[model samples]
Target chain A: MWEAADTPNVTKEQLQGAMDQRFSREIRQRLAEARVGIAGLGGLGSHIAVMLARTGVGTLHLVDFDVVDLTNLNRQQYFLPQLGQEKTHALCQLLRQINPYLTLLPQTVRVTEENAGELFREDPILCEAFDQPEQKAMLVSTVLEQCPNTTVISGSGMAGYGSANDIHSRKAARRLYLCGDETTDLAPFRGLMAPRVSVCAGHQANLAVRLILGEETP
Target chain B: MTVTVNGQTQEGCANVLEQLTQMGFDPKRVAVEKNGEIVPRAQYETTPLKEGDKLEVVRFVGGG
Candidate 1:
């Protein structure tokens, strides 16, 4: 980033060296060795993926069936030029731009109960970012039942214009970390905005980073 | 019988499953926790609850 800002020449080596300087040697090594699976590419998933990439997570298994519609610009991390592209493809391009040497495993498919286990088998952490209540519940239930070793960081209640303080996280179950207010569903009168959604997404990203680093969240 | 559901105190609930239904929750869509332990879906009906027991009924919400 210094080279980009000052010299107009930003090589991968320079980027890595700068990142290494910012993060401790041990943390950078650990982050570069870990892998995570993001189950959606919407508002929460997009932000979490970018945050993880910036932190230098080694591998990413991204799954998303939807395309970038005009409506997704409010909170999703996508450019207007990518309005019609597949979410996985667009996000992969964005990640590559951020980190040229990231091992990205992206697929364009809707996640279901039958395939969620295999999609996330290699990734120890699973992030739930679906846009439907039933879909989120299905993924969470499947992971808890089938993949006992994988930790699921799920979100809910992040809708409407409300207090950012309402968006917080909790350890819902043994392997489930939920981030949201636990209410505040979106209705016709109450819709999702960027501020509150990003707050929940930040919580999810923070929890994921902490879990990967084996640090307890205070 | 007074039991707390979702942090709200309510009366007349026989078990965790009954309480979930009485609170207008679709038992299949929600997950129940009794005293900080998750009650598996298969055991919600059989998991009995007594007075003063706290429960957390959580379900997914549709928002990005």
Candidate 2:
């Protein structure tokens, strides 16, 4: 069902080479076959999406209801030209440009507890990248309560300018993966900047990749 | 009283719930550990904090 990107007729061998020697061919193959979902398209979600795509992740199920705004330019991976475009569509374009072979399912709708079941069906692992705590909790709890097989990787407290060392990844109750400083709150006293957000995003993406590669920390 | 919360010692506050609120943590979003034992959310108000009591309170943040 997957057509070659162009008439040159590229092969899986070259696709694997995109990952190069840094990642094993076996890992690349595994990544190529893995299907993952990102629940938000904000700073964290966009970064995770890019990292996964660059790692040769074959499929991405992206959901975002918002559009690119000038404010998002500070941290999110989108460019200035992408402004005013629907975030899901803009992100899909960026991802496809990076890896044309990627299979992207971009849904331009807000995900709520009611639709969480339908939105994330069949994906083995989902990254919780919402900017709101209630939304994150809803997706996490909905999937865990309704669909027992799905694993959720979520971030919390990754706000404010702080030391990267403050951020950590913890396996919370159930199958939830929490990545962040665990204490940084977005407040008038503190702000959500790029460095700390990226730190949490890296942790979330790393855990997703590690899980796909079949590594269990326990 | 002094309690070691999230690895830092803090003075005042007698119970876990009170100490959390005093420190600007919303009890609703955080998971608390007292001396390595995970405390049920229901007991935060009743769980008394004593001198040298070590506590680990972790909460989720919003960004990205």
- The CA lDDT of each predicted structure is 0.83, 0.80
Fraction of the reference Cα-Cα interface contacts (below 8 Å) that each candidate reproduces? 0.49, 0.46
Q: What lDDT tens digits, residue by residue, belong to model 2 across residues A93-205?
A: 88876687989989999987678877887888899898876566556656765556777888888887778898888876556678887666677756567788888889998
Q: Name the best candidate (by TM-score).
A: 1
Residue by residue across A75-156, what tens digits does model 1's lDDT show? 8999898989999999998888788788999999988878877777677888898877878877877777667679889989
Model 1: runs farther than 4 Å from truth?
A1-12, B1-16, B33-56
The top-ranked prediction according to lDDT is 1
lDDT of 1 at A123: 73
Give the TM-score (0 to 1) of chain B in model 2.
Answer: 0.90
Number of colliding residue pairs in model 2: 4
Q: What is the TM-score of chain B alone in each candidate?
A: 0.87, 0.90
Q: Count the backbone clashes (under 3 Å) in each candidate.
A: 0, 4
